[model samples]
Target chain A: MTAVADAGLDLRQIEQFLYREARYADEHDYDAWEALWTDDALYWVPAGDDAADPRSQVSVIYDNRNRIATRLKQLRTGKRYSQSPPSNLRRVISNVEILGTEGSDTVVGANFVLVESRTRGMEIWAGRVTYKLRVVDGEIRLAYKKVSLVNKDQPLPTLAFLI
Target chain B: MDCVTATVPQAGTDRPDYSALIQPERVHGSLYTDPRIFAEELERIWYRTWVYVGHESEVPQPGDYVRKNIGPQDLVMTRDREGQVHLLVNRCAHRANLVCEDERGNSNSFRCPYHGWTFRNNGELLGYPYHQGYGGRGKLNLGMATVPRVESYRGFVFGSFAEDGPTLTEHLGAAAGEIDRLCRLSPEGEVELNAGWLKHRTRANWKLLAENETDGYHPQFVHGSIFSVTGSPIGALYSEKSTAVTRDLGNGHSENDLRPEFRRHGEPMRWFGTTPDRVPDYVAKMRQAYGDEAEQILVEGAPHVMIFPNLFIAEIQVFVIQPLSVDECVQHSTAVQLKGAPELNRRMISQSIGSVGPAGMLLADDTEMYERNQVGAEQLRPEWLEIRRGMHRERVDERGLRVGTATDETGMRGFWSHYKTLMEDDK
Candidate 1:
């Protein structure tokens, strides 16, 4: 996209950050995962259609900074049965593009396919992720992230793991 | 293609004796596992009973419609040009394909993709292409079939496939009071379900979700993780000390009533711990609409009631359980938006997302129990589920509804007795 050229950000740096972020999430490294977010982080997974506003329409998961902390805290307790005996997870992140830039943040988009295996069965999850990356103290942080699942509107199983 | 079919040997040629299977103190475990029993319930309970379809608020305007399911039968709930709500069986009149494919949309009519058979939103046949091939449309013995009766009580729509049976109001009986409580909390005396549903698929019998909806006993144990984190005051309501009671609101409906505990506090919004300043407009509007009774309305808040086979008013959300197979079901939840309270509605929506749904902090644990129960149901050694928690102490209230303590199995026993009646009756 022309926005990538206009943004003048290092594409290789962005890709490395995304790969590291994916690793932290797949491995359930809560500390590393939470550290990657900026203080004003907004993590969202919209339900039904992608365009439904969070302020109006319900979401599968919509967490501000405090909610993000609470979610990780719940998982840390080791009793969130949905993830008690956590499922084995591996996610492939690809199709990375620096969509554009706003203020000090760079907007990037990517496609992901995640395979989650548990005692019940295996589930194949695919979606598109939009991320707003910001640089603070020379370290890249996730300011905002929204996941638009292909099957967002359908009745789905437990998604306690980080998407 | 050649298909090989096999017949399995079973005991009784007739239906299983529901009276023996669903005893007063215990129920046979196979009711949760037997495919035959599930098939029977699909007819007697799902199709015959007045099952919740969708809210009238969901289709307020003409051309608005939403797709729903009762048992496995697909339906389209639509508002016609005359503003009458109709429940149309989604099959095409000509080829049996779904007439409306989208989950929801605005369309005056539905056109079938297979054979170009069109249907008005109200289930009337519009016309078909190449009509000369089949004698004119007047003689074709097919049209989109609508449920015989569709009725609404305060905007909650329910449909029964059987033409003549108990009126929706009769089926609701005293249970409608619970729905009224939820709506009366709204300043405008109405509730809107505009928030799109976040459906959570559960690998368990649909009855499990239904029973668990009002089982106040399980929350302290099933959702202990949430209590440990939030130190929720609401958790105290289910304890032995609290005065909250569970009711067998006749006709299979039941409730985990928290009013006694909340009213004891004599404060408003104690259900969710909000201050008056947070929802001043709502409080004021409610006071204006309800007069002096607003104090009790604010104190009691919304209800935690589940209506018979399908609908559950889960406090602030409209929850529906759609059964797919005997061991699989989906719980659809949409946050209820009050008609005139924007401030309270926003907070309720966020709270609904955090508490329920598939990934919710609280419900995920409950879902785990539901799935585990399914796995346990297959065991052969223990054939009965003991659900007579409060039978010894339960009492009939002034309204004739049986009542038990908060942490009793009164809700489940009530549910099963009602189920047995419907399953065993020929009518």
Candidate 2:
């Protein structure tokens, strides 16, 4: 395949992966969501506006694969009262920006708006998504999925759902 | 002016008839819902108290500035060119417009966005756009009014609104020991706030959080699922098997030390590293930096303590609760990292942050409970949020406030007693 077609194919595959992940999250199919990541994958939801790094400042959620599994396990075991009713979430990923790559990882960016419906009501969150993806056995795996929320600085209710 | 002056009450003196406003354990709903009482609190308590402005690290460099709101007043906490920190009123002396719009940044001086009137970082009079038009009335008329007094305890900075109130140290009182304890844990004896904070709004009264900080009785029940998920029982954290202990530390300070016994006692391998989950490498790093003993000491802090009214400092983290309206409050949770500590310690700080932040499982439960309380209180019944845990113990010592356990309600009683004193003081 030509390089252009190859890039197009890779982007399409990544989009499909994100769509699948969102479906699993909304449906609470955390097992499928777990499969989308490399064993060493990182999922970060930045707390503040300029949260480029979680090492220094507070992050909304900074979970490695293990921590994520723990969180999912906790949520599934009916032990997390915060998830008593279970938050219903729907995520829309658009405005795909292919910001090129840096050493072994394909850097792709997109805009995501997540709508979470709880017993209270629906909360809409918009943010920029930066994905660092690497191909493992011809399947794209998430190295890092960094979400910089638009209302990061604004006081938020408990952000139970992942963006 | 005399009537208005008379209305401004003194604390713990000529006490107003606040018996109707507050009870021994519970306060009237008007304390949270009434705008008039809220205004009185703004004028009498929040304004007079030594409120935390910001950290020195927030404005580490000269010209670095951060904006804060104390009660209804807007303030600009800035570092001057000479490295002196100043908490100046954001209102321009001329037209009362805010001088800075951005929350934080490095600025040599502040220029009113509405007009081009500029003031130095130290709130000194600077040139105006119409300087020639103002003629000789520049320095004499335009000198910036400073915020009465600004002081620093360790690296934590605070501002006082009144010119006659007690010094920041005096206002801090027994609470200073807790801050010092947190600072002393670090070998360098200094702590710096990490970059930005997690600012989020809650649909509940601000005082609810202040009460919750010192409230030990609610955690196990409110955070039932979180406790269950963590696998370790609450009985482990408290020394006493009591539900929770709230202790009056005297001088408006209190400790709601959740007793280790309240948690599942003696859960072996309780260290963050030993958990089945992927241990954050930062946790191991923190353990190494402090050595085994230091690590143990660090983990032993009484989980929740509030420094009256707005400042709630727990577990090396500081959260400022600002009342936005009767039904809502905005909380700013700033992550504090021990200066000169190992990088892993800072990372562990972040890991610990995950449990209490706006998105943390613990806070999520707390916030949900608070909303429920707020909604429940709207019915105007005789219902009271029970804070009567550990009422039997009356002993007090150098720990200042003594608690039955971490889950006792002594903290609430301490907070309410002070609240009543402040509300009733007919000074």
Candidate 3:
């Protein structure tokens, strides 16, 4: 594990990157959001209250880079009925912290509360996010992003937009 | 209690008769609305018929249990110390308070939180705080009342509140063959619900789910987005006139057979032998397990089977509808995986989640349509909802089952026919 001092990555820059990533998702900026991921990026939203291995248990979203691209393409086509009109989303990212380093990747943790408004109603989605970020050409790229929703175990309404 | 024996509708009122509401070719919208009809259904249909409770694998050991509901009645499916599974009413025998509240757990006994009343997992009254309170009581029997009949077929447990109706086998009828086919797909001829379940609350009548399970007519239209996005060949396969068949599997059960070739698209293995790299080991394992029957058992698609009121075995997924009210229901969707095939089970779980999870590509569309149907049903102008899509074209098979084309409403007619008989039995 590399210490924060040894990694020499600016905390403010990392937070700014996180905020920008979230803003792009909230605005449904698919291209910009897709550009932020590494070629082998993993996007996971585990089912139930606790996270489990995606291979062993069911997950709300467990997409590899290719699957993520396919999902984005579906959304781009405007044919996904769940998000036909797209969700009006705004998120508050807080409690950002650097959780040391794994290999060449910098692990980051943060808390988020996303509000999604659609035709049915507005839903308050709160969850914790963990990101494995790697530096590509001096720019932060996401290697893995996992979202653990607070009400994952409960019956959830349609989550059409990206979390 | 007299509500059960009340006339279908008051003589002078404008309410439509129950008989006219459910006819051979059509059904009235009030069947999906009308609190009176809903209550009658809870008693006559849900209570009398075989309702799927839980799978045997859910309680793999003694003391394991899961709470389930039949219509509005709460019950617990528990395995007793003697290894016998029991479906007991969750209410405490002492004061009618619920005995078990947790969704699932392994517990030797359930002790009521309100009072100190304790009962064995099998629903037998173990002890109370003060047993001598009523001078040994007046015919005191505090055991949790078990549903009249509890039975299982091929590890699928079902319970009926009515004591003298059909046995589970008689109730399942032709549906039992579907269950057998599902179990036979497993290399070891067994399946488990261990891959966790996803529950979604739908703002639609419970029957909408039953109708949607095998209704091959709406997939192309309702799930148009999915078909366009995933490029699934299901739309084409279903549209290939004579290739697919919809049959009214006797005793209210119905099925839509989209042919074995339909499994080529989106399933683990395609018919053209282009297997994904991730599941090669799993495919090899299946081949080793089933030998020559691997292609048929592993690759041949399973028909969409709806077992009467509640259970739906949709290929790799098993969906159970728990009706909360006339307008509300909870769908418990579980992925069925082979007992001995771990990697293949993982692939199955992934596919199930991708298509049926709360945020799934397919189910999300279906949910929206179901809610829309409920909203549309509120308009009383259209009194009857038609189920006569292929009424004239329906052909009787050698076994006396009604068979129709893929996009036919023969399955819906079969369901309504059986439902009408049960609701009107009155005896």
A1-163, model 2: which lDDT tens digit per residue? Answer: 1122223336677677777766887887867777778888888887755635677667778888877877777677665666777788888999886788867778889998888887767788888888887776666667888888888766677776656
For residues B1-427, could you state the per-residue lDDT of candidate 3 as single tens digits? 1122222344355543667667777777778887778888888899889999889998999999988889778899999888899999989887899888787899989899999788888787877776688565334666999998999998999999988888888888888988887886666778888777787778889988899888988888877777787787667656745367889997789998755445434354552223636666656766788788776655554547999889999888899898888988888887887777676677778777777866777887788777778878767654668899988888998888899888899999999989888876868
Number of the top lDDT candidate: 1
Which scores better on DockQ, 1 or 2?
1
Better of 2 and 3 by lDDT: 3
* DockQ of each two-chain model: 0.75, 0.49, 0.52
Lowest summed lDDT over 10 consecutive residues: which window, candidate 2 chain B? B1-10
Q: For residues A9-31, write the lDDT of model 1, one tens digit per residue.
A: 68788888888899999999999
lDDT per residue, candidate 1, B287-313, as tens digits?
Answer: 899999999899988788989999999
Better of 1 and 2 by TM-score: 1
lDDT for residue B211 in candidate 2, whole number 0-100: 80
lDDT of 3 by residue, A87-140 (tens): 899999999999989998889999999999876678899999999988877678
TM-score of chain B of each: 0.96, 0.84, 0.91
Task: Give per-residue lDDT, candidate 2, residue B53.
Answer: 73
Error of 1 at B5 (Å): 27
Worst 10-residue lDDT window, candidate 3 chain B:
B1-10
Candidate lDDT (C-alpha), each: 0.87, 0.69, 0.81
Q: Over the full model, what C-alpha lDDT does candidate 2 score relative to the true structure?
A: 0.69
Query: Which residue pairs collide, candidate 3?
Result: none
